[model samples]
Target: MERSWTQPVGVGVVTALVGFTSSFAVVLAGLQAVGADTAQAASGLAVLCVLQGAGTIWLSQRHRTPLTLAWSTPGAALLVAAAGLQIGWSAAVGAFVVTGALLAITGLWPWLGRTVARIPAPLAQAMLAGVLLTLCLQPITALTVSPLLVAPVIVVWLGLQRLAPRWSTPAAFLLALALIVGDAVLSGQGVTLLAPVVSLTVPTVTWTAVVGIAIPLYVVTMASQNVPGVAVMSAAGYAVPWRESLLLTGLGTMAGAGAGAHAVNLAAISAALPASAEAHPDPRRRWIASTTAGVTYLLLAPLAATLTALVAGAPPGVIESVAGLALLGTLAACLAAATADPGERLPAVAAFLVAASGVSALGIGAAFWALLAGLAVRTVLRPRDPRAAEKPRSGRHARV
Candidate 1:
């Protein structure tokens, strides 16, 4: 938190670490889902990272908030859906545009923003609980195939997290990397040599992609990812202009179109770390960390070759397993706050389970549907609490 010697650099560093480590797979899958070639997918990631980074900086500083801007996780899931529908890149871009527009619309209308903001804390807690469960599972899943590699790291990380809160994640990550490289050296395993991140290109939208892939991508990203991303930030205590942040991401994606970024929306769970961490306690300083992170991203993201190499060499299992373990603290903290109230915990948990189940009737993800379920439960159980029934007279979701 201080200026010199051991400042808030950790926040930015951690942000970038989490972004590249966890987000790489998501971006690759999303781009591939939309029919992008390896080159195109890499190009898109380079561009997306820069724009997303820049958005993080701008949003954090503008509001003096600590929020980290990130690509949509659910948006990636949307791409998985896009794959099922056999959509094209042109449509994928269009979906991003649509999502950007929807975010803009939500921001411009106070009612939508407020209504979304008003989701009961308990339900939010429940939703976050489910999110944490899924996240915690990633590392465990990784161990099934590579117990020799992942198990020891998990055990060490858990111990470190318990003993040293501030240093746990970074330390564990460093140790994991050491283990990864060490194993290669000792056993003569095929240790991959990684290049650093460098390069940039913008996005180019096509009508066909927009009409097909883009529309669905946008709907799912905004409704499923952005809404909750913003919700996560708000729940953590940073009051932000949702529309402005949305617009920033939209503009970033637009700028990145030529560079090849896809489905750039707010990051929900990952962003929560910097937005609420002790390193970013003074809300204004968070802006510095986030902005610094964004600027760092914009500058470094162009070199996909380097980033890919650096990340890939770590052995996918180690990177993801450490990632899952690192996030445990954040997940725990969120649930603690979300379930502070005993009365509302059940409905909240139910709503969260619905979201976590990944059951989608339409082309949308469960985030939106889960919120809807929670609202319905609240409406039914607490009839007299008119806030559940009355729409915000002014913002985005005020139609009724």
Candidate 2:
């Protein structure tokens, strides 16, 4: 019993640590990109920490499964891509609310879930790849501008990628943190720590934001996070209560929206940590791992503001370098999936280029347009035979 408790608890702590540290920079960048000030961004991060922690605990215990919740990292990447859109903070918050509602509706309406599922894997992957491109390029751009400050971080990341792939991003982030602190102290600009506060904003809904931010955010979260989360748990031999999980995460997203959180959903890559055999030899006891992760997230919640403040004060591109480095693997995976099917390559490329272009028209962002272009190309080029279109393709399903 003691051994069981210790092993799962330890794995749970690692799950929370990796999940938080690995992507918090992207989360902060996304919030800031969408018009959040430092305080509001911190609020977003803190609320997300709390919500995912609480949601994970409830769902894991209620279902007796190693289910974990996470903030939508790909959705955050989409927001980072939307940086130049100039959507106001209130509008962003409103989009968050609408995304939550869409998630909940998907849970209740099977048809809606099926509709989102029908989105071509290649096109979905292409959009995600497109969204990730600009942010992933930041490290290269930063290295050109500040090689001395950025090179060591990339070196550490590369070393870890070969030695311990899972730890690469976290280690790179720690090194970047050290560099940021050292630079600040040496420059006589002391880091100011701030208490975490859940700063609430009155959400303002708009047609532009609804189409621009909310719709793409919803599609990304559903395709990338929620769907993959279920598959991960299933692969672990646990049947996730899909409706319950969706409702819980949807409500959590809404609850945090006023506090500036973009969205929260089922964990994808991080879910494997707590659900794996390494967490516990006995699958029945694995829920303990996820429960522990939830508690760990709560404990880490207060750090959001201090970390946000530190990154805010860091030299330009320093923190962005870390964010960019953290996302390289994801970008590579997306690109691979986007180009997997020869038949879909043209449409996928069309989507990828449109999304990467970051173009906006009539207040809608490129992600929306990218999907439109890909689908249009796909429709024109799709096979006439229904049976042929339904034929299974040989390869792994493309996931964000």
Candidate 3:
């Protein structure tokens, strides 16, 4: 499973692309959601994208697994709710610092890592299934909105998947882009490109943004993003250094604080795609994908403006759909995993429901809540079921 250089670059490009805007777009939306001025939001985004990409690239390589890194997407979605609140930039940076520090501390704590390691694999797998289900459903359902626009793309994607499995999505994406452009030219309706925003407002340190925004950012990114991101790596055959990864995330967030970014943590689903059978079947050579992505990121860090603007201009539905669709395979894998055995079925369903419910009672995300609830149910029901022992016996037959 040793990856060659070419493998990393190719996989990295695919990974880099998802970040190109999906990361920035939602962050910008978050800033607006919280009522930060255009400049402040953009600055924060700049810090976020750069640090996130760098963190991802670095760890993804070090782990030699399909370690995808991403800023907290749901965090942005959360921001949409917080928009119109008056939060100062300094406070926001402070929150980032706090979150980073917490991550570092937790990562270094062997107890926490060991506890996480104890979660049954099927339960962990179900968590992924829940997220991917929601993500993929978003895009597939898009066809109802514009079948003409979306159907052909999906049809081709399906055909390509069966006929040329590896190239399916990318090929479909390129083909869709070409057709969209061709229609624009032939119909004499060129798409309007917006000017890239390049605001540079300095953040004034404040306590409010820290308490209100920063803490939540840190909480969700680690609990939501980092947890599952690591799961994908482990599933793909990498023996990860949990503490080291935590240090990288902490450092990444620190870098963001200086640069005016939000949160940067491991990527879960999309990064897994390149690492999965979809991108490359060989393992040894896959680290190249993250390496390639890192190089692409370092080269483009300077062009943050152009990149953000382009994504900003693109239809919101497009990117959301893209993410949702890209996650379809992962979602299917998860769904099948959740109910593989009779004993874990109910608790796994609880995990899925809680995660999908999107409830955040104490600054933590539903994913965390789901796991907790499911675990509680499982613990309560464990002694009663002779079938429960079926799980422990599983490790003997665990896959590489």
Candidate 4:
């Protein structure tokens, strides 16, 4: 009996550890990129942690499935890419709210979910790749700018990637944390710990933000996180409660939006950690693993302010290096998916280039334009249907 409980509990702990440590830097950077000051970013991180934990616990308990929820990592990456849009913090919060509303709508209306699904895979993947491009290149840039501070972290990451692939990013992030602490001590600016506080902002919706932020955020979160989450659960032989999951995540996203959190959705990659055989051989009990993970996230919420403060003090490029390393695998996967189909390559490439260019026109960001450009190129390059030119047969004597 002890073994049964311990095994799943261990897996749950690891799930939360890996999930949080591996990508928290990226989350922080993304929040900061989108006009959030350090305090606001901390609040965002804290609220996200709380919501993720709460949602995971509620879903797993209600459904008796290892259903885990996570903050929208790709949506955060989208925010990072849209940094140049100059949408103020309040507008960004408004966008988050709009994204949440859309998610709720998708859950309530099946056709909306179908429409989001119909966004061609290659185009969505290409757009994600383009957004990730600049962030993924940060490690290289950091190396050039501060090799002494960055190289050791990269070495540790590479070494662990070979030895224990799953822990590589976390290991690098830990090393970066050490560096940040050491620097703080050496500079005579002792690290200060503060209670995590949620700083609320009254969101101001704008047309530019809605076009530039909300729509793309919704698309990326749905495509990269929510849809894949369902597939992951399906692969694990569990039918996810899709509508309920969406409603919960949508509510969670909106609840935290005013506190700087971007969006929350079903976990994609990390969902497997709790749902898989690794969590429990008897799949019926795997919900415990998710419950443990949710509790862990709640415990970690209080540290968000401290972590954000430490990261805020770290030398330029150090923390970014960690975030960049964290995203490299995601970047690689997106690229592979974007270029997988021969027929879609040209259009995907077009979308990829436009998004990576960081160009904005008419106060709209590149991600939205990337989709449009890809569709336009695809339409132009598509081969004509032979049936269109053939005369229709109308009677019993016709071909039909």
Per-candidate TM-scores read 0.65, 0.97, 0.65, 0.96
lDDT of 2 at 28: 96
Which candidate has the highest TM-score of all?
Answer: 2
CA lDDT of each prediction against the hidden true structure: 0.61, 0.91, 0.60, 0.91
lDDT by residue (269-340, candidate 4, tens digit) is 999989999999999999999999999999999999999999998898998998888888998999998887
Worst 10 residues of 2 by lDDT: 391-400
lDDT of 2: 0.91
**Candidate 2 residues 1-400, lDDT tens each?**
7998999999999999999988999999999999999999999999999999999999888988999999999999999888777889999999999999999888888899999988998899999999999999999999888788899999999999999988999999999999999999999987877788989999999988999999999999998988898899999998988888788888878888989989999999999988999999999999999999999999999999999999998877878988998888888998898898887889999999999999999988999999999999988987777776676555423332
How do the candidates rank by TM-score, highest first?
2, 4, 1, 3
- For model 4, name the residue pairs that clash: none
* Ordering by lDDT: 2, 4, 1, 3
Q: What ranges in model 3 sit over 4 Å off?
A: 1-49, 52-99, 119-128, 164-166, 172-242, 257-290, 302-316, 359-365, 384-400
- Candidate 2 TM-score versus the reference: 0.97
